[model samples]
Target: MVSVASPVRQSESRGSIEPILAVTAPDMKRVNDLILAMAGSNVALIPEIAEHLIASGGKRLRPMLTIASAIACGYTGEAHVKLAASVEFMHTATLLHDDVVDESDLRRGSKTARTIWGNQASVLVGDFLLGQAFKMMVEVGSLTALAILSSASAVIAEGEVWQLSAAKRMTTSEADYLAVIDAKTAALFAAAAEVGPVVAGSPEPVRAAMRDYGRSLGLAFQLVDDALDYGGSAADLGKNTGDDFREGKLTLPVILAYQAGNDEERAFWQGAMEGGRNDDAALLRATALMRRHGTLEATIERARHYGEKAREAAASLPRSPSREALLSVVDFCIDRVS
Candidate 1:
């Protein structure tokens, strides 16, 4: 197996999300309760499938972002809780849909909802959660928040479709890959953070700062994940290593390796990405190429670039524990590969 270690390290506690969790604890409790309540349905299968994924050990970082942004902006209202829950529902809905699209078998170290409940059921339950999310958004009664999230939902769908089209295409550029991730992954994060300021009635500059922070953080988070697929353990990944390779997904590591490769190496990557070489040996060779070309490290460096951007954006926010926690999350995301 290919194992590459990250050069960056911090104190174990410094890299933990304990601060974010601590800052958002009370709000998160409400968010969790609302999630359980909203996920319930007359159709028992709906709750079963939804809860299967909802309770599947996700850190709920998106929702936490919503809560933290609001608190950091000095909002003292209950709407943030509703908005936080709504963010989580949107995230869960996307997870269900993504697993179906990716044909993924595992999520967060457990059987995917589709694996347990089947694709049709998973899709329908995802639809149900999305519906519930809109309902909560409506209850919160912020047109700005509603618009931000609704627009993000549409952007996310577009990103997924764009990624599907880009899949297995060897010519996919970094810009093209970045466009897909900006929509699929970062859009919701941007919306999740922006909605906090909207609910708090913070000024537009503050809103923009939080949104930028989230966007940069999301980009960094995904790059780290892509790097980890090649260099980290399955236990660290919460799924099998090289799942992206097996699925022929075009991520930054693969893109960089392909660009840096010699003709023989290019042929190897082309065959691998075209779905003709998905065996264990191919995965080893894929990682071997990535390591040899320093693509994994390059990818992590790219992530750190975005992590720095996220920190810069967070720096504009008011000084508070919540803000510091948000900054620490950037560190946590980039340092995970170590």
Candidate 2:
């Protein structure tokens, strides 16, 4: 269990985890330089903004997944580096847009792009990243890579729309929430894991296994994220806890709490759902209600379930150091507090 000890200091952010494959230190440096080169820019107006956000130091999880999956699949080509960079570009684009949509001021304990710059700049730079990602993909020159990324982008957009529309609507079910998360969060993860083998022409069964692995891991990751927003500290979470409550977003814990609460508890949450940041008291009460009704435990249990499935999905990949690393990463995902 994570100790509820002192106030959570920002440890080295999770995104800084070393790459799973046992690349020599020098080889890993080359990959890092390649990511920088791919993320760098020629555009005069927007390049700085892109660089600022790109350099914000995400763990590069998606790109790492692509690279790890490729290595596990016995890929020998240099294209994986470019493709992994493309994945990171796509993910960064989504974060820029998500911050704007959520009106979030902080990311990784720093001012978000929308807060540091403006929504307009953030959105426009996000577009630049999208364009850059496609350009990088073109350099890869494979129809399969294009297809994987293009479809994942479409699904992510659709998922965001679904969540935006569904927010605060009492009729939204667990299925509805799952659908939104699957689209917005899981699709890219699935693409990130699958693209490696697809690019390398791995056998069909192996490709499917990798896709399943990514899908399960993505679901687990988001579930843990949702849980942290309710139960985690601001220091640990890098933002205020209860943003979802203030914004009226009904994530899994709240959904389960809502379902489990009595009429009075339900009325309390309904009132809080429409309120804003000042409803910190209500958020704490709602969290208590979740604890009372066992929703927090349920959410954690579900995250663990998905993590197990993700590990299972990884089992069919051909044995390799990369495969073991991927499994260890799966173990780490459910362990995260924020």
Each prediction's TM-score against the native? 0.97, 0.90
CA lDDT for candidate 2: 0.77
- Backbone steric clashes in candidate 1, count: 0
lDDT of 2 by residue, 257-306 (tens): 87877788777767776444327677667777876776766776777788
Off by over 4 Å in 2: 1-31, 42-45, 234-238, 275-278
Q: What lDDT tens digits, residue by residue, belong to model 1 across residues 1-338?
A: 66555444333544668889999999899999999999998999998888888888999999999999999999999999999999999999999999999899998899998888899999999999999999999999999999999999999999999999999999999999999999999999899989998999999999999999999999999998898898787777777778999999999989999999999999998999985687889998888888788888888888889989999999999899999999999988877887
Q: TM-score of the candidate numbered 2?
A: 0.90
List the global CA lDDT of all models.
0.90, 0.77
Q: Which stretches of candidate 1 lie over 4 Å from their true place?
A: 7-14
- List CA RMSD, all candidates: 1.4, 4.1
Highest TM-score: give the candidate number.
1
User: Which residue pairs collide, candidate 1?
Assistant: none
